[model samples]
Target: MAYNDNDGDFPGETSTAREELRAEAREVLCRLVGREDADFHPGQFEAIEALVADRRRALVVQRTGWGKSAVYFVASLLLRARGAGPTLIVSPLLALMRDQVSAAARAGVRAEAINSANATEWDQIRERLAADTVDVLLVSPERLNNPQFRDVQLPDLIRRTGMLVVDEAHCISDWGHDFRPDYRRIRDLIAQLPGAGDRRVPVLATTATANERVVQDVAEQLGVAGADGSGEVFVLRGPLARSSLRLGVLRMPSPASRLAWLLTHLGSLPGSGIVYALTVSAAEDTARALRDAGHEVVSYTGRTDPEQRAELEQALKDNRVKALVATSALGMGFDKPDLGFVVHLGAPSSPVAYYQQVGRAGRATDHADVLLLPGTEDREIWRYFATTSMPDEHRARAVLGELEAAGKPLSVPALETRVDLKRTPLELLLKVLAVDGAVERTQGGWQRTAQPWTYDGERYGRVAQARLAEEKLMLDYENTSGCRMEFLSHVLDDPEAAPCGRCDNCAGPWFPTGIDETAKGSASKALGRVGVPIEPRRSWPSGMDRLGVPLKGRIPEESQVAEGRAVARLTDLGWGGRLRTLFTITEGGVQDAPVEQDLLQGAVQVLASWEWAERPIAVVSVPSRSRPQLVGSFAEGIARIGRLPYLGSLELVDGGPRGESGGNSAFRLASVWRMFSVPEELASQLASARESGQHGPVLLIDDRTDSRWTLTEAGRVLRGAGASGVLPFVLALNG
Candidate 1:
């Protein structure tokens, strides 16, 4: 359905040249697929023609399995045959790089990759590039900014590169769901290619998940069309609809019920594929439950060790596991052509992102099932991730000011001391600032750039609004009466969108919607299981002295708190919802209420299961300005149940905790250091309790433990007051 633009005059548009390139491309294509009769798909030859013959930058917006990789692989061979230098590909994932390198071998083209995982091969790859033996070289987008790679090898590659390909090209655009600041470096890479017309380094950018906005944004950003209209880019776009996909949604009442549906019906679907979750804890917890049910499954998340991730991915590829319960981190660049189905335990925030994930299935098969079991907590988790990632102006300014004042490079840890942002968000903020020209990542760490930057509040606000709108659209997709495929097509601006007559809306539920009581009970029990141990901190945070706190290295053993217990995580499947409700109801301002009956019972169960060396004889609560009554009553209830003395809360003095939540560890420690002291009566009792060491350990309790600094400081105060030992307990762990 693509109309030939023929709007620009460039090299190799001649009929003779086109005919010859087409014939040669078909030969390479046949080799790629191991089929002597194989030929280009509708847009593959045209895309290759655009890149090789015309020597033009091109954007191919096609569905997955539409031969996007084939076009580039074939084009790279053709360009190499023409005496062009190596094709340098900017891929976004190591899995993609691995797959690309292997695929290139089918066509007998040499390909190599240098990533964080293969640091030892950097030398060999550099030698191959110098020897002009590598036909295609793949690397992550983040690698473009590496101090050594940028200064040492990038310049030579840029000067002699034949063609450049950006896999998962949507990462470069802000409008895309999986946007990354490192991807913006592709613009700079393209700029440095150095040539015009026939001598130009023809570029190819490919993706399956780009919408119209993402398409246009990427096209503009990749220099497909310059702002001054000096260059032209050939764009080949096709429909996003997939006939192989049979989309459906199965709604469940609660998280337990949704998980129960999976436990009962997963094997009934089809072959091995993914079960996506919205958070890491949910992914890990769900995997454990599935495995406990005797399913051959494993969890893949951001927390999964890098080497193990590759093995897990291979396991799914070989169909050794039933499925990998994973987060969105498992997405992008993973290729499994004949995957049977993809299930979501909860809905992703955007339908566009959902399409990208579900598209993973049925790639090489005639049919694959895609189902969603929507949960009530889906939107809340979506909003948490959406808002937390946005860069703050105050934090941005603080980072920039420190870099400017230092007059030299500053590492991330050093910056943590001067700025309050956590490692993840702070790194993200630095990337955003780097893209905006306010700072640059250099040898030691980061340095302020000479370029000026102004905070764009309006732009950030608009993006946040877009995310909210997308969240609403995701809800609509969950309950829609229209064709689900067509709805997704329109969401992604697919021109050929039409009712497939295959979804639940069109055909009245093609999937099984029943779960037996046994399955539900198993799932409920798995979710109901609670109690995560809290590991006590052994050392004080660095740079604490700068915050007017005298602490360094390891904490004194006499003052260190013992290992504690948390009832559950805020994102846990079992006790998470009740705990979330507990905290959310009291989030806006200070409020006082006793612990609810159900949660109190859950806490008791945690205590019963806890293996203690000695039973505590006293309970002391941390003073909570926001939840005094809750913490106080919870402590008092524990004392009443255990027959222990109910000592008062440690005193809050010297203007209590200096900063808000989400600060770095250094600031968090500084905020709580010396902020608590043993009250007179509590100290008197603690003194007598430890005089003969007959009172045993004191149970320290709080509503939540964030940063764990408050508990550390409070325990230190109690130990100084003569308690033999301190034991900490909390309702939730705010990871």
Candidate 2:
């Protein structure tokens, strides 16, 4: 393989040049897969041509198994041979980056990655980059703006970079189903690259799932013009419908039915594959239910530790387990050619998202089963996620005002004291704001930038509306009168969408709709199982002094509450839906009602099963502004049933805690600081219990636990008043 410098410093233009490039790519492809017959798929060669020869921005929209990775590896090697710098790839997830790096190595491409999982290797990677020994450099989107990388390493990489590849490029569009704020930073990085005819750095972005709207948005962000405009960008789109997928929908009446169906029928599917749930609790509970039925299944969600996630992925890939009951986080960049099926316990909010998840199965197999079990509760879950993605105007302004008022960098915790937003949402808003040039993250913390910022209310509103429309489209998909795969492809704007004859509508339901009654009973039992221990707060939140609360450091052991119990987390599969209904806040305030009979029975079951050092000797209630009657009755019922005396409730002074629910620790802690005190009469009664050799933990009851700060603060006050120990009992755990 040789290049002529006199061939005008450009690789391909005439048919002869293209033929030569394709021949070389074929040779590299054979070396990559170790198969002499390996060749490019339909659009792969065109994408390579655009990047290597045309030196233009290109986006590839093809099916999951279209060999998108081969194009990039071949392009990188081809460019490197011609004296171009190493390719910079902005991958989305750490696991995905690892997969890419491994694949590149098989092609004999020297690809190195910098991610959260590898700190020690970074130095070695930097050395390789400095020595010009690395062919490709992979980093997560989050790393694009990291203090060290953005300030130190990125400028030089951008200057000499031969190609920039954005894998999973749909994330760049806010209108897309899975949008990340950090992904928008690529636009800025793209701007810094040289932009001339031949000297411009070529860029390639690829994804399997992006509608026409998303594709246009992503292209605009990448500075790529579509076919309607000047020929600045080249987009190679292929049919997204997978011929091997046999699709169907099983309408389960309830969560129990859904689990029972899975427990009864999972093995009937071809072989090992993925089972997706909408929430972590659902995934865990479903996996447990399946395991209890003698099925080898494991749970994979965002909460699964990164190390464990890798192990689990490998476990599934190796067929060591029957299935991985997972959430949406498991879908992207995972590859297993022989995966047999995909079963969704609940549907995703958009057709695009559903297609991406189902695309995981039947990639290389002759046949793979894809089934959806739709639940009535899915819309509520969709609404919860929808609320988080868009930035709250008030919250954004408050963050900017705090940073501007301070006139310096403040850590997130410091900002939390002054702003009233939860940590996750606050962090997401900061990323969005940072990309918009409102605030900038630095080594010290976040600081206000000189760039003026506008709220862009109309833009966010349009995005929200577009999301709602997508949700409606998803619902329509459930009851579609046409082929399921064709519907999904039409939603994604695939030009060649046609009825997939394998679907239930096309060929009749190939899946069993019957579930075993025994499985249903077992699933109900699993969902109904109660009692999750709430870990006690051992230390106070920092930056509390800013809120005028003089609390810091480890709390005294005597004042710390013992580990508490809740009937279940609010996100639990079985009890969670009911609890959510009971605590549903209306336009005015939370409803004040007594404990429901079934929940009271559940509480009694929790107490009977509790393995306590000493059972609670007495019960005391926390002051509740929104649900006083509910908390009062719950405490009284527990005290009566346990044969323990019911002490008086704690007294709320100074208008009872300030602010509303759902904020960061410092703000939440300070809002409830010094807000409660033990009643004198109750204090005397508790003191009598301790004096009379009844030195057991007294139960402290509350309706719910969000931050657990209320329990900690109340426990401190009760300890001061002479309670020997405090044991917390709550109706629900918020998170």
RMSD of each: 2.5, 3.9
Candidate 1, clashing residue pairs? none
Candidate 2 Cα RMSD after full superposition onto the native fold (Å): 3.9
Clash number for each model: 0, 0
Deviation of model 2 at 200, angstroms: 1.9
Worst 10 residues of 2 by lDDT: 1-10
Q: Could you give candidate 1's per-residue lDDT for residues 1-735 as a string of tens digits?
A: 133223232334368767887899999999999999897777678888878876778888888888899989999999999999999999998888888888889889899998999999889888988999999999998888888888988998898899999988988887777889889888888887754755688888989888888888888876644444424667788878899999999888899898888889887778899999888888888999899888999999999898998999999999999999999888888899999999998899888899999989999999999999888888777655655345698889899999999999999988988998788889988988988878988889999999998988887888778777888899999989999999999888887889999988998899888897888998999889878898999998887776677888999999999999999988886688778777774446655689887778888988899888888879999988878889999999888888889988888897687778668889988888888988899888877766756767789999998788898889988888888778899999875
The residue-by-residue lDDT of candidate 2 on 1-735, one tens digit each, is 112112232343468888898899889989878899987776677778778887878888888988888889899999998889999999898778878888899989999999998888999999999999999999999998788899999999998899999999999999899899999999888878877755678888889999989888888878733333322556667889999999999898899989999988988878899999999988999999999999999999999999999999999989999999999989888888899999999899988999999998988899999999988888877765556466788888999999999998998888888898877888889999999988888998899999998988998999988888999999999999799999999999987889999999999999998989999899999998999899999998887888888988999998899999999988787998888889877887778889988999999999999999987789999998888889999999999899999996999989888888878888888878889988889988987877788878889999999889999899988888888788999999985
The reply for model 2, stretches above 4 Å from the true place, is 1-14, 224-231, 587-589
RMSD in Å for model 1: 2.5
Clashing residue pairs in candidate 2 (N, C-alpha, C atoms within 3 angstroms) = none
